[model samples]
Target: MLSFVNTTYLGFENIARKSVYTSLSKDLALKADEQNLTTLAKNAKFSKDEESSFKNTIHFTDFVSNTKISLKISDENLSNLKAKFAGNISLQEDGSYILKKEAESIASGWFADIAYKRGYLKADANNDGKLSDEERKNIYSYYGNGGFYSTSGGNVATVMATEAYSYLRAEEDFRDFTSKSLEEEFNKTLEKDSDFNGEILYGEMMSKGQMIAQAQSYIQNEGYTPPTFLEDMMDQFDQLNKKMLKDLKKLLEEKRLEQEALEKAKKELEKTAEIDIKHSNDQSLDKNLEKIENLKSQNPESQSFKQSLNLKEFSQAYMQSFKVDLKKELILETLKKQNDINYPLDMSKTKIDLKI
Candidate 1:
């Protein structure tokens, strides 16, 4: 009975070992597959075809790998792995990849590399694998300006592709068969023009018009017809000039109306001041006349009393005239006080209250 028990225990031990080995082998295979997928994703290039497919498949693969690893790994170990790879990639409930800083940086760099390669190929005018100064300038003008790409679109790849396409199209449109020769001639003509002093004191539209006219005149004097493309450019300049003139006229009209309003306000203020001065003078004159009447009643027959009354009246009038002159300064002070209170005194709206 003891021999039979030992044999049964050995058989059970063998079965347990087989099961453990099977589980270990499966885990190893999953780990290998995860590594392979990650390698494929990191090395994939940005291509016109299968781009979206590669991105989706790789991101999904990464998601699956992380999910499986998270089941067995400690949280600390997983965090260390994420930090090491600079990948804080997360999966949304909708199965979309939420790529944070590192992933975005990688994708942007890739897109920029592709765009530069494509743009350089088109912009090399002599096909010598080197860009001329003019070609470089044109490329910068179209792409270096921030407006070439729309940031409102969330897809960085699509925005970069559009920018590349536009740069190539602009190159084709602006390129002449004579290459940079015509552009050089245009610059030389502008430099020779006495009116164009290599600086634009006026607005941009006016400067552009001057440049276009100068180019046209130079072409005509040399007895050569201007290119159709150049004439189209000139027409665009003309349209811009008309729009600028309209804007300038509207601005000038607004300024003129403002000036007229200010002048009318000044005249009204002067009229109010005159009325205030006249009213003050009449009050002073009445007070002086009353004083003279009182003196006449007090000294009825002094012989020199009339002379005294006349002299007093003349003195009061002279003093009142001096006070009126000082009242101009007082009015200015009152205006300043009103301004401080942001209360404009509109005499037309309310009667003036003279407190002389």
Candidate 2:
């Protein structure tokens, strides 16, 4: 009876040890899963309150079975068994395994974060988390021109289609998708399509024909049918492109007309300035001629006065016509050499034109 009791006690001890090891392995697995989920929530930009709520609600103790099971296994065997179950177990997207609203938020956040980081989405310049009309237009322009993959040596339409396909597929697989992994797959596809180096050369970049070919190749390879949202986005981008081109053409025409108007105004101002200058010069010449005639009438027979009168008439006829200046010294010399003594003329206030 002593021998049998001892044997039974040993068997119980083995079973208890195995049970403890199994429980410990399960606890470790749950802890790892919790860490991964917390990391995902953090990446999705969860608030501290949200994180706390998530930890309280989504933890293994809250959602999974905790009933201990009987087992008889060695320590080495237990370690092997734990390793076998160490593979990643992802949450489902259908809300069967997780809160539907919370899961959707996380997925949306992840997509937003990826799109922003990869330059496919624009941020609010005012930091208000909302797009203004102008910002919306800019987004349309960006997409019309091909978004982040714009420089990937593909046509705008083809690049846009590729990006749309990749995004939709990733969205569909959001539960298991990560930004890093998605980015890697995108790059791989783009490199294969375009034969990318660090940068694509201008000549090696896709032409419209090449783009069409590559796009067709992509569709065949991925067996992807673009969703309605993607199709709508593509249509919107095309419309935006057409509108932009039309606006650009109209702007160019407006600029051209403005430039022509400015040129015409300048010419008119120059012509008016020339007329005013000529009128002022004509008035000055008329006053000088009147002074000369009065001097000639006062001393009609004086040779010097006659010579001065003749010189004045000659200057008005030739020098004034040619826009030349009359010499003041010559005029003064002619006046000083007057033959008459009865009348003397003061030449002090006489003005001579000096500019041609």
Candidate 3:
């Protein structure tokens, strides 16, 4: 999620702009050479391939009046740097300098440092030294930052952490509410032995009308209502049972056809993907065969292509494995090997003797 922290600062003297870019470029180079950001050996190899590929590409200038600046790093160091920041690293189209220090300050450990600290702590409520959701929200609201930290001073550190934490806490609250609601709904539907047995069973086994008739019969026989306890229990049971059945059925049948359609779509997607994969493999094989044929046609015997093309170095590589004049091959091999190694002394340095 970390991107380059790019910021533009306007109005730098031309000399100042050049000096700033030169300093940044030197720092980047030192990091590349000594630190080596790539973790894998294969990554270094990939870097080399990209390095060569860029060299083969042609770049056109947008303006005719623009002058080109040429810079060179050894081929061995080529992979360590690829285009990177050539010449001026900071200048905008309008000729402005970027403030590197401020950019670094904004970008350095922006979220990571705060996230680690926010893990265990909660919002302290009542000054009791313990944290809960309510206390955390209260503290944040009081501080105007909506987090555990105070941001009234307008300091960058407090503002950034408090703001980020406030948003995260709100998200946590929403998720917790959704989960608790689901749990409550599940619990509401749960049946227990106490809900069905003994005194309740006698009432639950009878219909509401039957219970009413029993109560009336008892009332008529005893010349009184007989408290009507069973009647009341039966009525309540009937209402609860009806509600439960309706909810259970609704949950079961909800979106049944939509679920089926989604399953059918998933199967069709898998089938189409299988066909696409087969077609892709077929095309790839054809391309590979074409590349093989082209390579074969460019063999050492292809005199016509050789006369028109300057492919001497490439031809040498192709013929390197074959038995050829040992001396000639060694010389060619040494020259080619030079492209991949660092020589200790500068080849261009000349020793001079002066009479004083």
lDDT of each: 0.37, 0.35, 0.29
Report the error of model 3 at residue 75, Å: 99
Q: Measured by TM-score, how close is model 2 to the native structure?
A: 0.29
Which regions of candidate 2 are displaced past 4 Å? 1-225, 307-356
Of candidates 3 and 1, the better by lDDT: 1
Q: Estimate each model's TM-score.
A: 0.28, 0.29, 0.21
Instruction: Predict model 1's lDDT versus the native.
Output: 0.37
Best-to-worst ranking by lDDT: 1, 2, 3
lDDT of 3 by residue, 1-356 (tens): 11112212111121121110001121122233232221211121111323322232111110111212111223322222223323323444543223233222211111111111121112322323233455333221110111111112222111111121122333333322111111121111111112211111222233434433333343334422222443465579999999999998888787787788866875565455445544544454455445445655778457654552347744443333232344434444454465453323231242322111
54 in model 2: Cα distance from truth in Å? Answer: 58
Kindly report which residue stretches of model 1 are placed more than 4 angstroms away from their true locations once superposed. Answer: 1-228, 302-307, 310-325, 329-356
Which residue pairs collide, candidate 1? none
lDDT of 1 by residue, 193-289 (tens): 2232222122221233332333233333432232344356557999999999999999999999999997688668767876776666567656656
Per-residue lDDT of 248-340 in model 2, one digit per residue for the tens?
A: 999999999999997687556545544554565567667666766776678868886667656666666445533422343334344345522
